[model samples]
Target: MRDIMGMMGKVKEMQAKMEKMQEEIAALEVEGKSGGGLVTVVMTGKGELKSVKIDPALFKDDDVEILEDLLVAAHKDAKDKVEAVAAEKTKAMTAGLPIPPGFKLPF
Candidate 1:
């Protein structure tokens, strides 16, 4: 049927768009900071940690626990940002699609 053929065409187009979006997301970098910028983390949109930075002031032996906490917080913040970016990209890619309400794409 013509309708079925049209839907298939749309599906192919969506697939191409999704692949492009994935590549773009993988190339994105996000930064997150914690402890008043004493610690910072950089992560890719796929949630892979790219790097971490810590202020020299937090390098004292007695502040090991504090440094650890800051690192964790910074990493979490970066990951959250990455997730938000991915969500935004997905929303834009799926706009105007006939997906049902409350249906979430399995990413």
Candidate 2:
């Protein structure tokens, strides 16, 4: 049927758009910092950690636990930012879709 063909075409178009969006998200980066900017982490929108930075002042033998905590916090902050970016991109991609409430996309 003509209607079915048209619907299929739209679905294909949406799939292509989603693929492009995912590529863009994969190329995006976000940065997060903690401990008054003493610790920082960079991550991609796909949640891959790109890098981490630490202030040289934190380099000492007595504060290993504190340094570890700061690193954890910075990594968490970066992950949160990455998730936010992915969610925003997904919202834009699925803006008009009829997906049910509380239905999360399997990314």
lDDT leader: 1
Please provide, for model 2 over 1-107, each residue's C-alpha lDDT reduced to its tens digit, 9 standing for 90 to 100.
Answer: 99999999999998888888888888889898999999999988787888999999998667899998998999899888877887888888888889887677776
* Candidate 1 per-residue lDDT over residues 4-106, each given as its tens digit: 9999999999999899988988888999999999999999988888999989987667768888899999999998888888888888889887888767676
Candidate 1 displacement at residue 39 in angstroms: 0.4
Per-prediction tally of clashes: 0, 0
Against the hidden true structure, what lDDT does model 1 obtain?
0.88
**Model 1 lDDT, residue 56, Cα:** 90
lDDT of 1 at 72: 96
Stretches of candidate 1 off by over 4 Å are 100-102
Candidate 1: clashing residue pairs, number: 0
Q: Pick the candidate with the highest TM-score.
A: 1
Question: Model 1 reaches what TM-score against the true structure?
Answer: 0.90
Error of 2 at 105 (Å): 1.8
